[model samples]
Target: MPETRSYTLDIESLDLDGQGIAHHDGKVVFVDGALTGERVVARVTRRKPSYDKAQAETILRASAQRTTPPCPHFGVCGGCAMQHLDVAAQMAVKQRALEDALAHLGKVRPDQILPAMQGPAWGYRHRARLSVRLVPKKGGVLVGFRERRSSYVADIRECRVLPPHVSALLLPLRGLVGGLSRPDRIPQIEVAVGDQATALCLRHLEPLTDADLRRLRDFGEQHRVVWWLQPKGPETAHPLDPAQVDALAYALPAYGLRMHYRPADFTQVNPFINQALIARALTLLAVRPEDRVADLFCGLGNFSLPLATQARRVVGIEGSETLVARAREDAARQGLADRTEFTKLNLFEVDAEWLRGLGYFDRMLIDPPREGAFAVAQALAALAPAERPRRVVYVSCNPATLARDAGYLHHVGGWVLKAAGAVNMFPHTAHVESIAVFEPSATAA
Candidate 1:
């Protein structure tokens, strides 16, 4: 076996991917499992001309922020990083990640930094997809997260981060899989929670035997969680019991809203942060009774509903017809049908004329996926400096794209970045969810 080369370096900061930064002989090295202000010995994993990748071999000094992770699968499971750090430390790392992206990539920063959004650390996940693997040598199946740095599934019977009910189903699901003829071949389990009930979708490689179906049905009746069997892709997912006893939904009590979604629909796992995000986004919009607001890429009217509370009318545009229909239903359910309108459109390719055809809207609230709204943002950037929206609230999942779009809005759109902040949507991971507010230039009107 080749000996692993070791180097001692002082950790400077953390990168967006949860890697630790260290300057070794003036070359910037990023070491995994290292923290800021900690001196450690690292074994180089991959070497590059300008930098290198390493794993912390020895933490000669550890930060006070470091904590003993609760899960036994901490290091071995590839599901989460930052588990070894305190929640406060996790928030700090995320904040720095946002700041680094803004400074290094965007070359611009918000005039004010809003407080970081934080939430419950454990059992907060409303949705999850657990991997399923049958390891006959150990037991019947290894079901849970992937193993660290490997595709192999981590044998996790209990997960502290998932909602207690969902976590409790892991072992039973594993046992149930064992009863299946092709237990190992049966792939993953997806858990999605709605307001009234929880739904579990199990992906199977082959049709279930009659006896296997009975066991699954019995488990479903006992657990109160609807079981969905997926023989093919997500579209093939159907209830193990077609009685329609359970429905998947999530609620925004503040807005008197409850949304139903299929198991595969996009919903925030951390419900608390999402509620706060909706509240903050609407607040930033500062919607008035007479204001007309446009919710670009709106799904299920999460932001649109809240905006309707303040604005005179809210026009929500989404890429999927299903989501638009769902949003319309939600609007009717909330008695905001007259105030909120839903439209299905490709947000990526929209323009001023297209938007004008829909309606005249002065305020814009956008929440784009990880790809970000390159085209939508570019159009916003091209809006005449004198005719731009008075306020725009942008929510994003990817910081790089947010920064890229921010650069265009700040340098091109003649908008002032009022405030920006980070939200801890995915705890213990490097993913940063954030919102930014941009106001038109003072003299634009």
Candidate 2:
């Protein structure tokens, strides 16, 4: 049987995932619902040879940073982890986590840390995937985030992270799904909100009856939300009522750019931080009218189009042919086609020869996924001196990978780690979004 004993621990610090770190009986204990510098009585829920996991049974002493979570389902819902921590404190912790990842994993440091990018702490998540389950035993269908550290669906009435209008649909959604003919077959719902409209893409494992479709349309009309249905995969999603809503899009007024994306496409969850990040990246790159810039892993020309506004020419390379086509269309519509060119290429396998084929660029911007851009960095490092970009800006969703790539660029590629900082794109969550600037070393230049 698992250990069921309770122990008192003095919380020392927080781990990368916001779990409180404590030492108990010569072993490391990770206690949930505990804050740093607090004394808590915790019960061991799970044990391992290296570390143990526990739940705080009682808080003997609380930290000043602790606050009553505005969401009643904070502890039970897996959507957020650090809601109990003060908003400013949450940003500070994320910044520290980024610095720690860079130091320990990458063996490098930035010359300066930029200010943390922050926005409204609540009602900021423009996109989310909510789980749906039919629990007839307890009540009816449950629609929300999963239970913390468990596979079960959380019983939540509302979600504060979603926009006010979207949050108001939670209970209504539960009722709508519960009354469906195949309530148990509906597995999940994808929520995407744009400045103009809100959409719900329902993922159903079974075919919906005519009656079910009518009910879904009714719910959409009642709640002023567009209904999309996915019979199997993301590609199968389409509008239930074709004439109801326009294509989803967001605007970056600073750059005079509008980005239209499909519901399943990967876009930033927080529009506020996304705009800030783009502005900061462009400023760091220092693009000039005479400069030729390259945007690697550029999805739908998010950065390429904006760069075109200032650069002599901008070349965007991405892996998805569909996204490349969309980007090309968007650039033309925005009257930027003359200065912008997009190509489809898998960047993960990019090498020195591939880099040279792209020709010389004065500046470059890389916004890679969680795996980071190690291959891109290595290729850039191997480029001929005359062909290498003078400056590069990297946007990352994972700090560990960012740090590793930064170390390679700074140490092996002879690049200077000029500045780096964290972006609070996901408030109350452990996910860290950061950006960094790099320049060629004096000798290399």
Candidate 3:
């Protein structure tokens, strides 16, 4: 067993995970529930060769930026990490973390730090995969997020980050699952909310009985929420009552577009922030009526369809055939079939030859997953001066990967890191969503 000891330390800074960083006897210590510039008594929870992990036992001195977390389940639930920190301070911390990652990991910095994107901190999460556990010892079925650093399900009555209607379903969900025939077989619930509808995709390990379907329908009717059953995988999900429920969709009022997505399809977790992000990205790309833009890793054409509104032509490329088909269908529905086109390709394996075949683009929009776009950067770097896009806007969820790719664009591709900023998509959480603009150095001349 690890030895436990208490130490009063002054928090010097915060780590990327929102934990307070302090030094005790020359060893770095990470303390949870502690804020920077605060003095706190912490109990060591774990020990390592170079650093220690602790939980704040008592706050002797508090920082002005610290605030009382509104969520009752703030500490126990693993969903959010920085609730105790003031909202403004939370944004500042994330911005600093992004800059630190860029400087230290990528050896590059942007010319200007764009103002951080802000949105409603609470009730912003529109997508979440809630864990469902039937623990008899912990009182019947438990529904919500998992316990912090534990495998046990958190016994949360409600969540502040989720939509109000969805948050109100926690207790009811627990009861619904508890009364089911095979409560233990139900492993998880995927929540997806759009402007018009809310969907709950229940993942059941074993086959659900006919009675189970009836119960789900009854629950959906009571809550006025759509129900989807996932017996095997995401591809197996289907609506309980397709005839009664409308397809899940969210409108981008600014772009005059509405995006349709399945419950299992990937969409931004925060709709409001997504709207602001799309606007900012489009502005940074500076699309003109005659401009032709390429959107790489364009899942469901979230950016492509919007770009088509301003740009003369937009080509969206994705690795998933399903997403490409959906993008094309959405484009056609939006009467943008003439201005937009989508293709399915493995972007991770993209080469200069493949890129050249796609034709010329004045600007490029890349919203890659956490792995980043190393291949895309390499392909752009290999392109001749005449064929390369003049400007590129990168939307990233991981700052480290974004910085690395930014470095490649700057050092290897001879591009300039014009500007970058953080978008607080998942507020009160450590997940950083950011955007960066890169242009050829020659453009400055």
Best by lDDT: 3
Q: Write the per-residue lDDT of candidate 2 for residues 258-363, one digit (tens) a residue.
A: 8877777777899988888889999999999999999998999888988999999999999888789879988998999999999999899989898888788999
In order of lDDT, best first, we have: 3, 2, 1
Candidate rank order under TM-score: 3, 2, 1
Deviation (Å) of 404 in candidate 2: 1.2
Model 2: residues with Cα > 4 Å off, grouped in runs = none
Residue 398's lDDT within candidate 2 is: 96
Quality of model 3 by C-alpha lDDT: 0.92
Winner on TM-score (1 vs 2): 2
lDDT of 1 by residue, 1-445 (tens): 1227897889888876667898876688998888888899999888788988899989999988878889888888887887877788888877777777888888888999989999888988888888988888886787788987799998887888888888888888888888888886788888887768889888888888899888888988888888888899766878876765337777878877776677766788888888988988887888889998999999878788888888899999899887898789878877899998888888888766665565556799989999898787777766666557788999989888988888777777667778899999988877889888988776542
Best model per TM-score = 3
Q: What TM-score would candidate 1 get against the native? A: 0.94
Show the colliding residue pairs in model 2.
Answer: none
Model 3 per-residue lDDT tens digits across residues 1-445: 2548898999999876779999998999999999999999999999999999999999999999999999999989999999999989989998998999899988899999999999999999999999999999988999999988899899999999998999999999998999889999999999999888899999999988898888898999899889988999888988888763446999999988999998888999999999999999999999999999999999999999999999999999999988898899899999999999898999999889999998999999999999999999888877878888889999999999998888877788788889999999999999999999988877421
Quote each prediction's TM-score. 0.94, 0.97, 0.98
TM-score of 3: 0.98
